[model samples]
Target: MTKSTQGFCFHTATSSHVEPLPNAKKAMAILRAAGMKKINFAGGEPFMNAEFLGQLVMYCKETLNLESVSVVTNGSKVTKRWLAKYGEYPDIMAISCDSFDETTNVKIGRGTGNHLKTVVELSQKCKEHGIMLKINTVVNRYNFHEDMNAAIEEIQPFRWKCFQVLIVPEENGSEHTLRDARRFLISDDEWRLFNEKHRHQECFVPEGNDVMASSYLLLDEYLRFLNKGWESRQKVF
Candidate 1:
């Protein structure tokens, strides 16, 4: 099989620990050298750095000549006007909506209730501005049964919906109890079952292998701006 594309995730340095800018840049350079295209920006919340994001998007379009640029975000901070402004610049958007229920959503999103509503509204707004909208749902033990159905039902009208099993990354100081990735993680068997039950529509396991050369450029730019050594950091896996 052909190798997967490389992509990078970006987050602000102000809060929420673990900086991956260095690694991301390195990956970007590798992808670019290999003549790769397409880039995706994901984060703790990308909208947190509005100015940086705008510059990054522009750089991807101009410097890398990338055909596809996407951002995955939690629709807590963005508005319809802000989306309208950037909608033309970026090619696609994937908004995270874990649960349709407000109470469960608050628990999963940590005080961000009404995220489903916000994301739905944002999706509609994106459609108006000629942007493709995708919904991302993290299925886990807590909301697996009902949440999956809810997500499929609500997001079917949209262009795409990505259902992913929960992956508790090795950051945020919960490593001790979260040692077993399989314990809290969903199995491939579970995914198969979910797929069979939701056969009426097409759902996909995101191919995180896609690499974009611009990601490396973004990483290099971010590191040069900060002037720090992040070469020895631990991997999230």
Candidate 2:
């Protein structure tokens, strides 16, 4: 049940646009109390609250004596200096990249042309500064069949790359629709086959305790746990 041996742990907070709540300081206190040292900042997008994020990073590094820190980003709102500063604090940067192809990237709601390019460039910058970089891809039916290998190839040079099977929450407020869910839903057998096909490369299954939904924490400038149902899901295969 402890975090490190269990894998990773996640905490969530409400976004500024969504509601008013406790700030990042309170959120960090809660996480520290839970015995978490490594933390991640996720949101509608973390960069929206740049100053607050910078403060949080500084506080966690100095006050909590954290071992590692990370942010899951979209790559659009970050600057080279911000990335560099984030790197200095020993934080890992994981950018959400569904495809390396621009048209496909935009079609999937990521953004217009050169978004992936920007991410690639930023990732390189992160490497130059010795910050860990990870590419996070959400595999779905449209892009799952053919693009997986190419996505891997595009991101292979980075420090880490991860593929997550899309999960649809049954709850009414879930952002995922049944149609979107169906597009990405693969059976465990299919997942095994996909793994086998790409078995030549290293792949990471979420550590026993570090399930993405569980191990990391997300907040607005004011931190809060956004999704509560995630903690109750059955174990992923």
Q: Which residue segments of model 1 deviate by more than 4 Å?
A: 1-31, 147-154, 157-169, 172-183, 203-237
lDDT of 2 by residue, 42-147 (tens): 6546677665666677788877888987777776777777755665774687877766677766656666677777787767777777777777665444444443
Error of 1 at 94 (Å): 0.6
Which residue pairs of candidate 1 clash? 5-209, 5-210, 5-211, 6-210, 6-211, 28-216
TM-score of 1: 0.66
What TM-score against the true fold does each predicted structure earn? Answer: 0.66, 0.71
Question: Which window of 10 residues has the lowest lDDT sum in candidate 2?
Answer: 1-10
Please report, in order, the local distance difference test score of every candidate based on alpha carbons: 0.52, 0.55
Q: Please, what are the lDDT tens digits per residue for candidate 1 over residues 1-237? A: 011111111222333333344454454555556676887676656777665565566566666677887777776666666765666777787886656777766655423465667777777777787777777655544445552555666655444443444332332113442122333345666655555655565544432212221124332223332212244443322
